[model samples]
Structures are given as structure tokens and as C-alpha cells.
Target: EAGVAQSPRYKIIEKRQSVAFWCNPISGHATLYWYQQILGQGPKLLIQFQNNGVVDDSQLPKDRFSAERLKGVDSTLKIQPAKLEDSAVYLCASSRGQGNINEQFFGPGTRLTVL
Candidate 1:
């Protein structure tokens, strides 16, 4: 049994540049989530997907941040014209279903640094 997978564990870029992160959830997991965690703060939910359909994305910044779960398996998160404030860890998680009892498993996360 394998866990979630993420790419480019660390990234650094200028404030105006763009950056993208990738994630592959565990097999048979029906729900996927993306979160943003700033230093000293708890992770914030950015987006969620149930299978290939988007379940929630209200917290996602449409102006610069976007994410998608393709075919209900792999996912990608991108930030365009990144801001200094966007420096944080992007976390990917997955669960079997939508319920409080369902345990969500998280990936290692991608650390982004904007200069």
C-alpha cells in the first residue's frame, strides 16, 4: 500500500512568477483536498474534489490560485503571478468519503517561497 505523492518538495520564485504543484492521491480514495498552511498557522482548506467533481473551492483565491483533479486521480495546483504572501506549504489530502468519521490522509506537502 502506497501513500499520496507530490512533486517538487521545495520551490522558490520571484513574487510575480508562477508556480505549480502536483499530487496523486491513494487508490480508491474518493475525496481529494488541497490546503494552504502558512507558518505558525493551521492548514486552510483551499479546494476539495469528490472523484472528478469539485465539491468545494470557496476558499481558493480565484485571482491567482487554481486546482483540478483529473479523472478523479491526479491533481494539480497552480499560482499565477505569485505574491510574497503566498509563501507557504501546499498540502494534499484524501479521504474515502465526505464525513467527519472519514480519516483524511495527507501528503508531505510542497513548500513555496516567494521572494
Candidate 2:
């Protein structure tokens, strides 16, 4: 009955600093996703996981951004040496299945500010 949960709803750091965000998906959900949403732009998928296996991560910036889903439950996203451009909302979502008909439930995002 519970929804997805995220930690540190807001974060502020210098441009070169690193930041990390955490997410716990809804119960019984089999698919999880991490998205980045800049102001005035729609969310962009950064990575997706089906259970504990990574399904997609092509859009993730390997040099600075990384994410992982542990045991098909909790997830974490981190950005190292954060850039000004990385200031945005990091969203976590989960769905029951990978099919098109499945509706994804999103958690309250983590807002990151890079000074």
C-alpha cells in the first residue's frame, strides 16, 4: 500500500562536489527507473532495471553518473564532480511489469542545486 520513497528531498552543493540519492520502490513492482528532469523539460530516462538486472542505461553519463538496484528493491543514484548543468530533479519510478499497459508510479523527486 505504500508508495516509493526517496531520501534528502533537497540538496545543494558546489559545482565540483558529489551528490548521492536513494530510492525504494513500491512493493511488488518488478521494474524500476531513474529519470532526470530539468526545469521546463520532461523527464529523461537515465536507467532502468528489471528486478536486479539492468535493462537499460544508455542515457546515463558513465563518467559522472551511476545507479544500481540492489536485490530488486532499493536503488541509489550518484553524481560525482557534479556540474551546474546537473542541477535538476532526480525521479524514481516503478511499474509492475515491462508491458506498455503498466502504469508507473513515481516518487517525490530529489532536487539538486549546483552552485
Candidate 3:
């Protein structure tokens, strides 16, 4: 089976600019997640999607960040007017189902830098 896949493994943008990242989860996975990881911190869950519907997004910054999992297969995350503090590695992960019983497979991640 293939693992998660993410595009633009690296991105650099000026502050207040816009950037977008894409993710393709495992073929049979039904649960997908997006996470942000700072240089020295663990990954923080930004959003979660079960099929085509959002499951969680309380941590996502609505003012500048948005994501979608259309068709319940591939997903995209966009950050408009990016901030310096937003620079981090964006991770895409997927699992067979919800809950801790399932193991999540992760993509390499896209590293973002805001200048």
C-alpha cells in the first residue's frame, strides 16, 4: 500500500502572501488529518476529515487558514496572508478509521518559510 503523499515539499513566501498545500491519503483510508509542526515542537493538529466532511478544526485559524477534502479523497490547505509565525512543516496523515486503535500513516510533509 502507498503512504500519504504531499506536494511542494518545500515552500517559501513573503509575509502576507498566500500559499497552498495538497495532500493525497492512502487509497482505502477514510480518516485524514493536517498538522503543523514548529522547529522544536511536536505536530499540532490543525484539522481532521472523515470522508468528505470535517470532523475537527477548532485549532485552525479561520482568519488565515482554510482546508477542504472534496470528494473525500484528496485535500488542500491554504493560508492567505501568511504570517512569519505560520512557518512550519505541514503534515498529512491518514488512518483506516477514527479512534486510537487505528495506525496513521504520514507523508513527508511540506516545509514552509515565511519571509
What C-alpha lDDT values do all the predictions have?
0.94, 0.95, 0.98
> Candidate 2: misplaced stretches above 4 Å?
none
Q: Write the per-residue lDDT of candidate 3 for residues 1-115, one digit (tens) a residue.
A: 8889999999999999999999999998999999999999999999999999999999999999999999999999999989999999999999999999999899999999999
Q: Any idea what lDDT model 1 has? A: 0.94
> Cα RMSD (Å) between model 3 and the true structure?
0.5
Q: Name the best candidate (by TM-score).
A: 3
| Model 1 Cα lDDT, one tens digit per residue, 1-115 | 6998998899999999999999999899999999999999999999999998998999999999988877889999999989999999999999998889989999999999999
Query: By lDDT, who's the top model here?
Result: 3
**Residue 70's lDDT in candidate 3:** 90
* Model 3, runs deviating above 4 Å: none
Model 2 Cα lDDT, one tens digit per residue, 1-115: 9999998899999998989999999999999999999999999999999999999999999999998887889999999989999999999999997988999999999999999
